[model samples]
Target: MTAEIVRTIPGAQKRTNDPEGMRKKVLDVAEASFQEKGYHGSSLGDLMAAAGVSGGALHHHFPTKKALGLAVIDERVAEAVAKTWIGPVLAAASARDGVRLVFEAAADELEKQGFVRGCPLNNLAHELSLADPDFRAALARIFRAWREAIAEKVRADQQNGGEKGIDPERFAALVIATYSGAMSMAKTAQEATVLRQCLAALPVSGQPAA
Candidate 1:
């Protein structure tokens, strides 16, 4: 009977009595709002309306706007980074190739979207990193994980007789910084040219010396 109930309403995540479900719904709405409008730009009312929950329901899950924003950063933003960057980078042939593929994919995605909304982690970091200590810490942790993942791949390539003498940590940082700045530029230009140009500039194409 219980399994049938779940099967019938597989999409029923907004059920009022399900606190966990309700929390997830609110977080999803808040994450999108933050990505689209920024932290300060998105009001609690806006989140509630978009989430289709009462003010009390929203408050019960998130007592304040900051709490909601932090949750988005910790959960939604972190998951996105893992999916969009970390996993793909690790799964690629080499760190260099992985980095190139990431840039190419990002450019393609922005083109498909027809407008750049910028990277989610980058967007929130710019708006909230300095606004609060907790925000900075959370964003910094994600950045570290991202960089380390790249560095890990780089080290793997080094072991396999590629990327000789390259400092994995520094190389990883450069890859991240380059893409981040390029994305910011792309957002401003409302096009993917900067992203493509940045990708071209990266030394991700050559083979290591024997």
Candidate 2:
């Protein structure tokens, strides 16, 4: 039976009557699982067990594994990028300064978390981009959104006479590429130092603090 039909089951109704809550729970569990295990490595069974939901409940929200992964990308990963990077960069005085601040903040977080895993978008892109066209498109959208956000800020900074020498598009690409590469290296080495070094070398047009 479909998840909608199975939701009528007495136990299912009692446990997950709130559709939004169930969906969020599934996304939360799936995001963690996918980040830890990659898309292929994580299975529907693992999601069901981690989310404490039955097969029917899982299917009700996400009909297929690909659907679930895309939802996680659109919802969880996109929200994370907006919150962590886009928002902060937009709020900063200049794009270059924003890049510096965001990287420093991210470095602090990585240090606290021990830096074993890398960027979620990068991790998934490496795992699923070539294997699935849908995944590639979904991830490409996120990366584009992220790059556009930073690029917009960079353009604004240039117009405001902050850093006219740098190309906004090129700078944004550099920031993303550098961070993604550093995170991969950090994950491989199981060390936050790699990330710190990369952040230190970022070509942000900001002066080091005295």
- What does each candidate score in C-alpha RMSD? 5.3, 6.1
Pairs that clash in candidate 2? none
lDDT measured at residue 20 in model 2 versus the true structure, 0 to 100: 61
List lDDT for all candidates, in order: 0.89, 0.86
User: How does model 1 score by TM-score?
Assistant: 0.88
Maximum-lDDT candidate: 1
Candidate 2 lDDT tens digits, 73-187: 9899999899989999999988877888888888788788875767899999999899899999999999999999999998888777777787889989989999889878888
TM-scores for every candidate against the unseen true structure: 0.88, 0.87
Runs of candidate 2 with Cα error greater than 4 angstroms are 1-20, 205-210
